[model samples]
Target: MRGEVEQLVGILFRTLAEEGYTEAQTALLDTYQSKADTDREELAEELFVEVVTNLSYHLETETEVEVLVTAIEQLLSWFSSLVEAAPVAILAVETDGQIEFWNDGAERVFGWSKSEVHQRPYQDVFAASSDEMEPHLAQLQDGKQLTGLETQHQHKDGSIRDVRIWAAPFRTRHERFEGATFVISDVTEQKQREQRLSVLNRVLRHNIRTDVNIIHGHLNQLAETVDDTTEHLRVMEDRLSNIIQLSDAARHIEQLRDEGEDGLTTIELESVIQERVTRLRKESANATIRTTLAESTAVVAHELLPYALDNILDNALEHNDAETPLVEIAVSTGETAASGQTTVSVADNGPGLPDHEQAVLTSEEETQLNHSSGLGLWLTRWIVRNSSGTLSVNKSTWGGTRIEIRLPTQTS
Candidate 1:
């Protein structure tokens, strides 16, 4: 029994030594070596009391350090909670491209649960091919931080999501770079809005420059000729009105931006069309306006749908060379409520829209030679696009042009 106690005490001291209790290890070693023949029970108790005393002394002396460690742990826990609850995705990845952390926001934004992606390769979260990820990985490995990197990622549903990422490399206490933390925000809507503004800004500047040059030439011509000035004056006045209308169209774009998502509201399609038809009838008495609107056709569209309709209706009449321009406005819906679409069509019995004029809506891009005569059609297309709708220009049954604006039904 005495030999067993000695062995156990020796084992305990060895464990303390392995755990870096150097003072206790040294004391135990000195006593063990110098007092091998001493009474085993007395030796055991003496060493036990010495260890207990040292433990108590250390505990008392390091109370503040322990408290500080506890506080730091609590602060880290709070920071982790904040990152998890953030509205944007937060990801932590190792230098080896392994994902270490995926917060709740990451799961929400990317549609991948932490359990699904934890410890997976960072490449798994992005849609980019390995070749495409190489450059970004190289940059990270070089300890470079990336900011506002506008890119597209794939959601778990296989749909694309536009995002802007901010990432920074993190290091260990010894300043060795180990991994990167990524902060990603969904910027899909914002990018779309910026694209819209860019397109409109470019087109407006081009058209305004052309109109100004034409006006300058007209002013020079008027200065050279005083006879039959009536026609020249009419042309100048028309161009001036067009310039004003273009400026107003820019204001409409601003209004759309200002209103943003709030601009979309449920509207009764038939009533809105009837109201515009009535107003246009008063404005263009010589033109015949007809409507075949379905009763209570409701859709979720931009509040500026009426303005879009006005542009189409007015274009149908204005571009018509017919002595009695006949304009037809019709509203149609899918066969079933679940089909989830409503189409408003404007047809005209006149010369069909020229390809250049239609290019503003149909073509992916507008060149200097392939641009529209005005911004009306462009504005209409912009409104339809921002409303999450589609606009189609096709041939009408009456040997003219038919413009259709398709919107999501309220039931959708």
Candidate 2:
């Protein structure tokens, strides 16, 4: 009996040591040596063997019990390092929208330290609109993965940041709702880049289409008036002039690189609209132009403000069906305590744009709507987008198309 008791004690110490629980083994050894019993010796030996065998099976064979645990530990370590090393903000929130983990990246991106953000509600970290948070929370709860969600995020410094968040829900061993993990990256630069590209595409499409159509019409006229060589020569000169203008415009567009949003300058909104309206009147004798611009609305942009306004005006004039095509430019301004964005609308009594046309204009494939290839309105939309403005096509009061442009005002 004494020998069996000693054997049980030996097995417990051996199993604990093998598991790297050195302290547990030493404590068990002392307890077993003191509580040595002869009558229950056989039972203790059998129990000890069963416990060791079960533990070994758990560590080696039970995939969910052991493998998953080790994998999770490694994954957690890797994710922690990634969040700490990343340049963007990152956070892990529970199912209830409470923040469980906040990384250094979050600190750098949102200007909140661990002490400030840990275990707090995500809403407390930054001011978020219900419109923005509701949809995101719904997606997380549904276990649907979301990517590239663009919304405004208020910063600790009282400035607003345009942020894009990618998020997915995390589950526990029982497949129960644990929380959500988010990897947020600053996409402000990328958004600006897309806007710039859209503007360039719009300019190219509108100018190319208009010039090509003009050239085609002129050629057709020349063919009909070929009997008079003088008229043909005059038509040929006009076409050549159009070609030269297109070449110059192309050069200007090519010079616009994938630049950052740093060279933005304050621009007079009324002046730009007036210039475009005046130019359209002189260029399109067949079209009647009108204006209702506010006296001193201003915005921020590069030198492309004139070109963007020109594209909008040209689209309105070209698509109009009135005997004397009439285009109206209306400008207005407003302020929101939140973003304080200035709104300027350029509406026309032209034919309303098609649904597909609107979709193409807002999409990244805006270049596909080339005027030379039948994509004029699409390009105009691109220009509005590039200037950090919103463009929408709706039914005009004159039973035609209304084009609205909303731009952000420059901060004083």
lDDT of 2 by residue, 176-295 (tens): 778898877766677678778778766775787787778777776777756655765767767665665555555444434344254356899887777777788788888877777777
Which residue ranges in model 2 land beyond 4 Å of their true spot?
1-75, 78-246, 283-287, 336-339, 354-357, 366-379
Q: How displaced is residue 74 in candidate 2, in Å?
A: 5.4
Q: What is the TM-score of each candidate against the true structure?
A: 0.50, 0.44
The runs of at least 3 residues in candidate 1 whose Cα sits more than 4 Å from the true structure, single-residue gaps closed, are: 1-90, 93-229, 258-260
Top TM-score model? 1
lDDT minimum window of 10 residues, candidate 1? 63-72
lDDT of 2: 0.66
The whole-model lDDT of each prediction reads 0.79, 0.66
For every model shown, the clashing-pair count is: 0, 3
Q: Candidate 1, after superposition: displacement of residue 14 in Å?
A: 54
